[model samples]
Target: MNRYDNERLSAIAVLESLRAGVPTRASTKALPDLRPNLLEIFKEDLKIFAGGQNLPGKFVWGKYGQGKTHVLASIEHLALDMGFAVSRVSLSREVSCHNLFHFYSKVAVPLRTPNSTVFGLQRLINQKTEYELLNSPIQNEGRYVHPLPALIFEDYFRTEGEEQDTLYGYLMGNPPSDFKSLHKKARGEKPILKLERKFKPSEHATAF
Candidate 1:
């Protein structure tokens, strides 16, 4: 097949994946030439995200076979390349936007990061745990007393064995019941709590 035929076949394959309710592989390149205007709009939104600016919400509307899924898959590929974690969930009767809980659950089910195509949440927690271990002190005096590493594990171990559970709850649109307690457990120090609370809710929420 020539280059044009290959691209056409690739696009068709992506559409088939979408139809089958599977995410396009991260290695799949977006055929922006198929929808130049939509791709340009996605690029602009990505620029705003990369620059650490607040991006306004976008609503994409199109009929069947109008390349909506293709546009979305293209955006996902670009977002991952730009170091942003992304999740794509189709809105339907079971995962309606009107229901926050169900919607969050659906979104969490498909979470993806640049390095992960599946089980992204588990990978995220594992990586963070590794980071904490690496940053933890080896010396006797500083091992337990260091505030940073203690705080890290505290969050990881907060609520006894419910650390992962708590994380799941948070990702599914339920903030932990006691942020204060979680913070204290993570830090194990009274002095640092005051400094931590100074951060705004938005800042604190994005710490992950």
Candidate 2:
């Protein structure tokens, strides 16, 4: 289709979503912000975070039908388009923010990057070499609460096919009982557990 045709289709899609009482990333982009001040503040906060500064995060509060979710959806899309990795989850009976490890599993598995609709970091992981993987900041202790994810990340690089997928799944929060066998096949050296600190879910959720 022509450029104009594509734009028209996208506009139609945005309108359809809005008509259904849901605003998506396309809808956010097409419509003018109802609360520019709030959005601008968030954009600035994102900029600060991107500059290597940590933020405690911001809270957006509004009564029902006030578009709080819409604003957050917009920010999620904006951050992804800016080349940032974004994971979004809503709290429910099954997924509560109070449980750190469970919450991490929910968010980590749905990881999204700028260009792909598929979740997880498989493509990015495959692009790196062993040297790059080992030297990356994640391998350093004190950066995160635990070094287990970093070790699994390195293991992810050493295996391929189903074994690689298993390790990747572990990194995404689904640990398999037979993972040690896979690691042995890939590295043929010391056990992976021996190479890193023991992971305690209570104390190590932050690492992933």
Best by lDDT: 2
The residue-by-residue lDDT of candidate 1 on 82-163, one tens digit each, is 8888997766788786654546666766788898757547556655543455554522333332233334444664444576
TM per model? 0.55, 0.86
TM-score winner among the candidates? 2
Task: Report how far off residue 172 is in candidate 1 (Å).
Answer: 4.1
Candidate 2, residues 61-89, lDDT tens digits: the string is: 99998887889889998898778999988
Candidate lDDT (C-alpha), each: 0.61, 0.82
**Clash count (model 2, backbone only):** 0
Model 2 spans with C-alpha error above 4 angstroms: 1-4, 190-193
